[model samples]
Target: MSKRATIHRMVTPDHLCPWGVKAKDLLRRSGYRVDDRHLKTKEANEAYKRENGVDETPQIFIEGRHVGGYDALREHLGKGPDPKEGKTYQPIVAVFAVTGAMAVTTMLSTSTSATIADGWAWIRVGELCVAFSMCVLGILKLQNLQSYANGFVQYDLVARHWVPYAYVYAFVEAGGGVLMIADIATLVVAPVVLVISAIGAVSIVRAAYIERRDLNCACVGGGSDVPLGFVSLSENLIMIAMAVWMLGKGSV
Candidate 1:
């Protein structure tokens, strides 16, 4: 016989508990027959919780044993802990990996003579990758400006002094990225990037080194759980390097 599970979840005309939906889906996928119970009103849900002595909904029972909420259900099923509950660098790594592949493909497609063996061509590819990454990350932040600003202000020195700076950071990264990719107005662009990235580097150093605080990096997006430390510091330092490289190459 297939295993059997029972779940109590909150469901109302205007709202549905997300965890409840997930728990039901998980049970079905794990080959269990589910007895779904929905509490249709806020008062009903609260009363149920109070009666059961549980703080949250989506409570599960399998074979007469209580399995708790979503996270607990996952643990009981041997699916490991929920990834969203912990830090992850997957977003940033994915952005860089995809953009890097795009840069190589673009360079090869545009020029028959372009090869990885060509030193200057490889340098150009690297620059394109960085510019593309910046633009993509900027778009992510812009998609949820308020969330980005909330996280950014926690660690950014400039944002700490003036809250509006958090709102403007996305535009600066995207604008500079566009200018960098276009290879126009290098004389102006290089200095601006240099200054901004230098300031960012210092801010990261103070927060991660001097003060020793663990923080979420707003570089990818505010929703991301990537830690603010080496990777975040590397981003600013790389921007500084790009600025210096452009200036030294006399791209103006």
Candidate 2:
């Protein structure tokens, strides 16, 4: 006979506990027949928690032996909780990969007709990559401007002082990216991005390096969980470099 597992989870009209669902799925996949018990109301949930002497919901019992919550259940089943489930660089990696591919394609397509030196052509590709990446990131931020503002204020110096800067910042990035893509308005767009990115780089240095405070970066967007550190700093630095490169080329 298969072992029986019981899960006491909260399922209100407004919310269905996600961990509860995950636990049930895990138990079933592990060959255990689960008795899914829903605490439908807040009072019922509180009462069940009192009875079980537990502060949280989604309590699990395996074969009438108390096994605790989701994390405990995973440990009991000999599978540790996935380390990469929460904090991940997958989103940033995807953005970079797509932009890089676009840059390479654009470069290859124009390589034969290129009037510039080979080295300058490669630099142009790098500019395209940065511009595209910035556009994508800016779009993500603008999708949830309020959310991004909330996250941005945590570490951004300009955002902390002037709340509206976060929203403007998104537009600036997108605008600069668009101009860069068309290879137009380098005199204006390059300097604008350079100043913003320089300010951002300094802010990052102060927050992540000097202060040593751990926080989520709003680089990718408000919902992203990418850590506020080297990756974010590098992003700002790349923008700075691209802006400088464009300005230098324009001068020649």
Candidate 3:
């Protein structure tokens, strides 16, 4: 008898989250028995994150070993590929984060589909998800920047541009996230869609430069290893375009 391997995946309330489902399905197909532990709330999930320092959900562990998230698991199985790091490149921790985030954005931009009865539930829930994600990410980013402030602040970069830029981003994101709760507020969503997409574009560029030799992705607020290449670039670019098109049409 073949010894069945047991795989444990941490599943927070993000079951409806595309990435979570993808992780679950992929693990099942790999022939490992999946044990899912669902958390009660984001606070509970954060408690887990504190121990693991991994902010995202659907973490797959194989036989008690920390295999990784969806992308890492896929790579381990040789089914999906995230290439090895180049000589000068740091290890990448996000082989699938870019694509995953793109999928998330797609769901978030679907305001038209959200107008239907059941669809409203999905949209409203998705809005909450976005709001939660944004707030968590923004707070973490601000904290990270705080340490780096002295380096740039000495030159007045923060005073002249960084502070204003951050505020503009915060206002748009926080306000648009609130407005995104309903379809009638599509007007607010438009600018927000553009802003996030633009921010993604800049990040893609910066990512390329910062990781010229390839490196682990710190995009999702943790250390995840994934290959860096066209896949990453394409994902970000596609997401930017999607945001642009979605905002322009006032629907998806």
Q: Which candidate is the best by TM-score?
A: 1
lDDT of each: 0.88, 0.91, 0.50
lDDT of 2 by residue, 1-252 (tens): 999999999999988999999999999999999999999998999999998799998999999999999989999999998465577777888999999999989888878755445787887788899999999999999899988889999899998999999888999998899998987999999999999999899999999999999888898888788888898999999999999988998888
- Arranged by lDDT with the best first, the candidates are 2, 1, 3
lDDT of 2 at 41: 94
For residues 1-252, could you state the per-residue lDDT of candidate 1 as single tens digits?
A: 999999999999988999999999999999999999999999999999999999999899998899899999999999997666668888888988998998899888876674656898889999999888878988989989999998898888999999998877788888878888888777887888888788888989999889999898888877779988888899899889988998887653
- Per-model TM-score, in order, reads 0.83, 0.77, 0.34
Global Cα RMSD, each model: 2.9, 4.0, 13.9
Off by over 4 Å in 2: 82-91, 101-125, 150-164, 211-215, 223-225, 248-252
Q: How many steric clashes does model 3 contain?
A: 11
Q: Global CA lDDT of candidate 2, please?
A: 0.91
Pairing residues by index, what is the TM-score of model 2?
0.77
> Between candidates 1 and 2, which one is better according to lDDT?
2
* Selected candidate, larger lDDT, 2 vs 3: 2
Winner by lDDT: 2
lDDT of 1 at 52: 95
